[model samples]
Target chain A: MFEIKDLKASIEEKDILNGLSLTIKPGEIHAIMGPNGSGKSTLAKVISGHPDFEDPEGDIKLDGKDILDLEPDERANEGVFLAFQYPVDIPGVNNSEFLRMAYNAKQKYQNQPEIDPFDFESLIKEKLTVLNMKEAFLSRPVNHGFSGGEKKRNEILQMLMLDPRVVILDETDSGLDIDSLKQVSDAINHFKSENKMILIITHYQRLLNHIVPDTVHIMADGKITKSGDKSLALTLEDQGYDAFKDNQS
Target chain B: MLSKTTNPKTMELETLQKQARDAFNTLGFPTKRHENWLYWTPDNEQKALERKFYEPSDSIKENDVILIKNGSLRSKPNNNNLTVSNDTHDYQNENLSFNLDSSSLSYLNTSECSEVITIRCRGIINEPLQIRLESDHTKDNSTVNTKVNLIVEEHSSITATFYHQQLGGAFNLTNTSFELVCKDNANVNISHVFKDNKSKAFFHSIIHMHEKSNCNHISYVTNSLLTRHDTNVTFYKEEASLNLKGINLLTGEEQFYNHLTINHKSKNCFCKQHFKTILDDKSISEFSGLVYVAKGSHEVDSQQMNQILLFSDSARALSRPQLKIDADDVQCAHGSTIGQLNPEEIHYIKSRGLTESEAKALLTYGFAEEIIEEIQDSHLKEALAQDIKETVRKIKS
Candidate 1:
């Protein structure tokens, strides 16, 4: 289970996440819908231990263990994954080599013996096929010149390869065309299991149609204002966030 | 003997030599006051310049190697398409076309040089040629200075690698220079490498491009105490282009200095000079590249970029990329970047589970690959790729 309690974070003396909290049990998909600057992205960054929020006042635990003191990479190895809203371009870094390094890192972190690089290639090819990404994508520099849709698919490719217990897709649907959206959603559904936890952070209800969530939460002013079943998302999408904002106020 | 002395060609050579002697005597050595030698002019180098070096006596003619030691040609190939000579000729086919006072060292080389070795190419060479410039010292001889001239005749093509190595005592100086000429419709590619450790060295290359000629020059300079490279290029005719690139890898307390002057003097010419330097430990890299376009040289294109990567906090980088455009229809741009490994790049790699140092090493290796992949010759490209890999590995550990 993934849980956040009283998460209070600030950036450059400005409050961003004020007493925000959520709990995600195993075998559940939760979608966070919110207006811009409602701390949705900040919440994801705080969970993953971004350096900007160095000493956030909160309790972030995974499987009943407090992980607030962990580094970003440590959090990643601890099954916390954040698909960035805007993926950074790392020029000159080969895609396959980067994935292999990431995979071996998690392996070494878990005290498991490192797999041979040759074996890792075959493993990555399987994941690439599932994501429908070409083999040439593995040779080019990581996200250096990739199109918008391609970068989103690359995020899914990483999720498939690492198989983290907690997957946080932050705006992974924006800027993606319909075909890419369905493809990515299908892969996410395929990866879903009873032992995994998924958090989908998006503004539109379109993505939720493909990867249906069990619960929907409306975030405002850095904290959850309302929580309900799937139909609540349809209500908010139909009436816009203004209706939800009036109700919250 | 009297006829040899009275020949007009000999007279012309003797007059030029006399002028070079006078020029060297007047210019002497550059000091801190010289704008071009500011950061590199230490008083101790003057002592090294005064050291005496004797001439080499042995010679060997090989198939594809031009081997030289202490200003003397030791080996050259015996081929019909290639001719190696040191002869004085008429103005129409003269080998020396650069200014004598391009640098003070060039003047000294001209005055003290016993003979000028010219390697001329008349047709396409199937295999790439190798120029081996080496330095050695014993009880009798301890210092050396050498230079060579390369000429690609009209409608000819050639590829060559110039490798300079120093294997002398810790306290020695090696000075060398070369002048290359690409005649009308000629094509040339050159790869230069310098590996001199714990010693001081200076190398200069003066290049001239004629009508429709093209030149690609790449340099790999590293592993030296104090290394200085001075390159001067002049586009003398229309439709000529010069693509110059280099990589300087410095570690420990090593220092490398680069200075270039690119002059686009004719219409429809192109000039590009890009250099990347990697510095680690307490090393330093200094670069100054200037691209000049004359007033009437319209439709000329020129670009200059200097990128420096520092692996340590104490490493220092100084860069100056200057452009002086006098043509209205020309396109010219210059940029300089001095940075450590990208922080975002580092974070992205680290988030994938790599430790900080491993991430840094991988980025460093990749930075080198982007430049090495541009070389056209496969053999040279592979060799440089391996060399840079080993160098980066050493830097990482």
Candidate 2:
């Protein structure tokens, strides 16, 4: 289980996630929908322990244990993975090499033996099939000269490789074409399991139609104002977020 | 200082040597007043220049590889076409001239050199010729000077590699000069590897290319106490091309300097130069590159780029990429960039599970691999890459 209680986080003295509270249980896919400047992405960043947000008030717990003091990589080692909305381009670093390094890092943290290069190559090759990517993608630099859809797919590719317990997809659907959207959604569905939790944060309800979150929360001014079943996403789609501004808590 | 012409064969050479000695006396050592010698100069020990001649106690036998130890030729390769002579030739017809005359190092080298090793390639050479210049731990506070001349005939090709190594804690000074001439339709590839040395070394090279000649020059310098390399190229005829690339790795308090100049004196010539340096600790590096297109040399294309990566607050890098185009129809471009590693890139790599040091090593290796990958010889590339990796590891430690 993953839990965030009154998580008020600020950057440069301006609060972004203002007293936000949420809980996600295993086997459940929750979607947070909101208008612009409503802290959807900030909540995800705070959960992943971004360095910019300092001295966050309230608590974030994974598996009922406090993880507020962990570094970003430590959080990642603890099964907290955030698929960045904007993946950074790392020139001269081979994609497969980076992935293998990440995988080995997590393995070392868990006290497991590291995989050899040949074995890691085969392992990542299998994951490429899930994203319908070519072998050449592994040889190129990470996210360098990649198309928008390709970058998104690479994020999901990493998610699959790491197999984190808590998966936070922050606007992964934005800028993705319909075909790429379907492919990414399929990859996400394939990664879903009974012991894993997924949080999808987006401004549009279109992505929810593909992944079909079990619960939807309407956010405004950095807090969740209302919560309901999946049908709330369609209602917000038709009625718009303007209809929920009066319900801010 | 001209020894009484005991060898009649060198009487003409003695005259030229006297002229060179006079030139060195007139110009003397470079001072802060010289524009190109602004950042560095010979260490305050005036004895370095005074100890001009040191005879080697050991003699080298003849072998297939040219080996110079303590500034004396230890071995000479026995080849029919290769002429290893202690006498000087009238090299004026070879277009031997220094591009930057602010320093008298070249004149000093010419005046003090004991021999001039010359290799004339007629047909295509199947094997690469290797030259090793090594300074052992036997001597301290001494000076050694050597010179080489290479001429490639028409329709011939050859690859030459020079390995310079200095061992021990001696504060020796080494001065070297290389003069090359490429005839029409000849191909020449040369590589220089300067490895861990505690001595102060200065190298000056001049190249002249005739019509339809192709030349490629590559250099790698690793952890030298103080080193300066000067290379000048002149296109004597149309359709000649030059490709030059260099990488420097510096750490501790070491300093490395590179000065390159290309002169396009003919039409339809091309020249490209790329140089990169990685500095750590309190090391310093400087690069000065110039491409000149002479008058009436239209349709010339020249490009030069210099990049530096600094790893410490005290580490410094300076670069000057200049283009002097006198012809209106010529194309010239130059760019220089000096920056530290990107924090975001570092964070991104660290996010993948590498420690801070490991992340830095990987990034630094990646930065240098750009130039190493351009080397055509796999053996040379692999060896250079391994040396770079070792250097990167030391930086983190």
Per-residue lDDT tens digits of candidate 1, residues B174-281?
777788999999999988888655567778889998999999999888887878889989898999988899988999888889999998889899888889999999
Interface DockQ of candidate 1: 0.57
How does model 1 score by TM-score?
0.90
RMSD to the native, candidate 1? 4.0
Which residue window of length 10 is worst by lDDT in model 1 chain A?
A240-249
List of clashing residue pairs for candidate 1: B60-B74
TM-score, second chain, candidate 1: 0.92
- Badly placed stretches (over 4 Å) of model 2 are B1-12, B43-45, B53-64, B76-93, B98-102, B125-129, B137-139, B168-170
- Candidates in order have lDDT scores of 0.82, 0.81
Candidate topping DockQ: 1
Worst 10 residues of 1 chain B by lDDT: B1-10
Docking class of 1: medium
**C-alpha DockQ of every model:** 0.57, 0.45
